[model samples]
Target: MTRIGVITFPGTLDDVDAARAVRLAGAEPASLWHKDADIHGVDAVVVPGGFSYGDYLRCGAIARFAPVMDEVIAAAGRGMPVLGICNGFQILTEAHLLPGALIRNDHQKFICREQRLRVESTTTAWTNLFDEGEEIVVPLKNGEGNFIASPDELDRLEGEGLVVFRYLDNPNGSARDIAGVRNQRGNVVGLMPHPEHAVEPGFGPDSPAGARQGVDGLRLFQSAISALVGA
Candidate 1:
């Protein structure tokens, strides 16, 4: 089985959920401690959401310096599949793993809801399972979800098709309504939504039918495992 690591920092609230999602995706879930300096030979890594380091100094600022991050950074540089969700996305930016930064929501409040998103690029490791233009509903909860970057960077991301997901309705006021993005190599991806939270049918966000229960987010984990094994 493909082993996927889920890192747990001082105040991580969603590491367990990410692990469960990995398992559901037919991969072995490895629990990695923030104090550890290694990735434990996992096939992929997931930085789950939470108020890491008590959300001090900023949501993910302090957590970016955790011991586990050094290895994550190195592994990602080597093309390892890595997915950062919500506060995890913030840490990725702080660690310079993904371009751009997540700041306070334009509304200046913690927003929680089932967000609608369109799959913009399916070339990324975590999104290959989705088809381009696919619409998905995932749970999004955070205070600092606004994504921003320099004009040049934005132009590059757009030109290179690196933007992975886009919002159907602007939520946190992200530029171009971008809900997620991937690195130049497409191995690293970060998004301001809780895909792990929407992996299970009954437990996930409700679909329009109210009975079909959406698990649109499960494919992200499954896709990462497929990408690793294929490599």
Candidate 2:
């Protein structure tokens, strides 16, 4: 089975959910500590959501220097797949793994809701299972979810097809409503939504039929497993 690593930093709250999602996708979840230098040979890595390092200094500024991140950076440079969600996305930007930065929400408040997103690209390791233009629902909760980038960078991302997911309603004032993006190599991805929270059927977002049905996020984990199998 493909072994997926979920990193746990101080103040991280979603590593367990990310591991569970990996398990549900038929992969083995490897728990990795922030202070550890080794990644334990996992095929891919997930930087789960939470206020890492108590969101001190900045949202992800402190956590960017965590010991495990060094290994993650090296692994990612070697073409290992890395998925960053929410604060994880902030860490990715702080680590220079992906472009752009996350800032405080324009509303200046923590927001939580089931969000609608349109898949803009499926070439990334984390999004390969999704179809282009497919709409999905996932949970989004964060205080610093606003995505910002320079005009040239935005144009570059668009031209290179690196924008992976786009918010339908522009909840967090992200540039071009971008909710997710991937690195140029397509092995690293960062997004503000919490896909792990939406992977389970009964416990996820509710559907129009009053049933709790938001398993759309499961495909992301499955996609990583598929990519590993193909590799």
For lDDT, the strongest prediction is 2
Estimate candidate 2's alpha-carbon lDDT, on a 0 to 1 scale.
0.93
Clashing pairs in 2: none
Steric clashes per prediction = 0, 0
Model 1 misses residue 85 by how many Å? 0.4
* TM values, all candidates: 0.96, 0.97
Residues 3-101 of candidate 1 have per-residue lDDT tens digits of 999999988999999999999999999999999979899989999999999999888999999999999999999989999999889999999988899
1-231, model 2: which lDDT tens digit per residue? Answer: 799999999999999999999999999999999999899999999999999999999999998999999999999999999999998999999999999999999889989999988999999899889889988888999999999999999999999998999999988789999999999999999999999998877777754344447788888999998888998
Worst 10 residues of 1 by lDDT: 205-214
lDDT of each: 0.91, 0.93
Candidate 1: segments with Cα more than 4 A from true spot: 206-212
Task: Give the Å error, residue 105, model 2.
Answer: 0.4
